[model samples]
Target: MLDPLAALRTPDDPPCDVYLTGSVFLDIIFTGLDSAPVRGTESWARGMGSSPGGVANMATALARLGLRTSLAAAFGDDKYGEYCWESLEHGEGIDLSLSRTVPGWHSPVTVSMAYEGERTMVTHGHEAPPEESAPCDPPLARACVAALRPGEGQGWIAAAARRGSRVFADVGWDETGRWDPGDLADLEHCEAFLPNAEEAMRYTRTDCPRAAARRLAEKVPLAVVTMGSEGACAVDGGSGENAEVPAVAVEALDPTGAGDVFVAGFVTGTLAGWPLADRLAFGCLTAALSVQEFGGSLSAPGWAEVAAWWQHVRSFDDQGRAALRRYAFLDALLPGPARPWPLRRAVPTIGFRRV
Candidate 1:
């Protein structure tokens, strides 16, 4: 891990830099499909991979960015759960002290099909029994990633924020077709709210995404609106800072969890005290890099990936000086000639026969 906040760490500081809570899912992704599976006909994918998904996407993304990530979630006793636990705790170095194992419930499973840079996912599983049996209180951390939803109580975010954690909130699609901002009462406790262009427009009732972000800024200290290929824009209500960055051009494979990676990258830059535009660009770059790979959690770019991409693109001299200039901040953050340890793409299965 690169430890982007190493300079700011102290013995008195919270042990974790980022904290999050949500359901972890075992994801099986199928790629290289010419089209969606035909009805009454079988379709075979040319590529497939298995890894942890759901909130694990954001956790893995944060950990890969060198943040001290602590996750509070419930895991199943199934073999798939075992694989997901091993991947996050041991493989990615995430802290799972606040997590627990449900004995009877099986892990949630999501099968995702990737076609034309987008994905369709079908998920199955039963909810684990209530956490009241063994309540796992959240740990103190510098920041928290709160996945907001309508009609869901997020009292823990308020508690964490009171304890000095900067809360960054994002929401899943409002399935009820009611994007009622009033339902999100916890926005008062958050430092920022990140929503895609569509969601932002719906919530703020604005014609343009930037206008939506501006309106959202009135609700939270920071408002971020992500536009698929156009890029992302942010408004900092406190500092009156406005930043917008264009998306990095790259061939996208599986776009699952790309949003999580972008949030992770943005959080890293924010905690590191980078300029607003630089933070926006870094988030765009990390998310773009993630879509080039297979799975969401495993595909998160580490410092090595950042270092390598910087060196390669700079030497190529093709991105144009204006385009590359925004990323000049990376030169100061990367170590001298650091190479990535190894690629960690997901495979077809967790188990393989020994040679």
Candidate 2:
């Protein structure tokens, strides 16, 4: 596969852009929690809000970074699905022509509880993966596949690759139960693969995430395994060397969708012609900033914020480094505690505990 980033500078082709394909869901979040209730008992609720999530978050992140982006995914005709589609359609600058609405399927939904800005989610609606369609425009199609499925999600990717687009793939947690090792033939054609630590460990059946990442890099041109707080490692097939990028220090509130934000940041940086090291740093920074907010996309920082953070951290002289050490000291001294949201008064409490 050709480097989509390089292809962007080609005189004959139009400016390079990204096409996002996958699931988009409505995220309902409950906030203001004091503590999790004992099993079989009712819990109180503090607050609730709904926002756009899933592929919509990824696409929105890319668009917010000033990339030309299009979303290709499935939605239902239900009101929630309509809201999902409308959110993407009205997104600052995203293209939604490729999005399809399935007549009977319900749009995906995720209910989350926020504690100290960190969220725990319960999700539904994964039986409906988007149906593969014929290539629309070859270049656009290639970029599109990168966001959809690669390897196991191969049919569409192969089609797009054959049309000459550089493809990248973001592996999701659902793959843990859904993917079969034999289904990885299509991964051979991927230009880049992004899998979080848990996903990489599960897919490769290895306890060492770096080792698993190396194994994946052996297959694709680039493979990244992100380890929260420990930072991320990127293996370049061309150099056969793995490099580590340290994570930025930040107060983590909710970790929901941090990996997705990371993928969006990495891919955006990749398309911007950033080197591997810088790309990983930017990706980690993006994710760290994401946890400080409540909703997924709503938590993602804009390009200006991302750039400023990057510059500030990179400028760390001895005093700045000392400040970082002090910050780490304070964090260690006062380990943040988890708090569950209060339950609704009308909802009956149910108690259950697992050993």
lDDT of 1 by residue, 114-146 (tens): 998778999999877887665434578999999
Q: Which pairs clash in model 1?
A: none
8-53: candidate 2 lDDT, tens digit per residue: 5665553437776777888876667766545798766665556678
What range of 10 consecutive residues in model 1 has the weakest lDDT sum? 336-345
Task: Give per-model TM-scores.
Answer: 0.96, 0.77
lDDT of 1: 0.89
TM-score (C-alpha) between model 1 and the true structure: 0.96
Q: Which number leads on lDDT?
A: 1
Best by TM-score: 1
Query: Global lDDT of each model?
Result: 0.89, 0.67
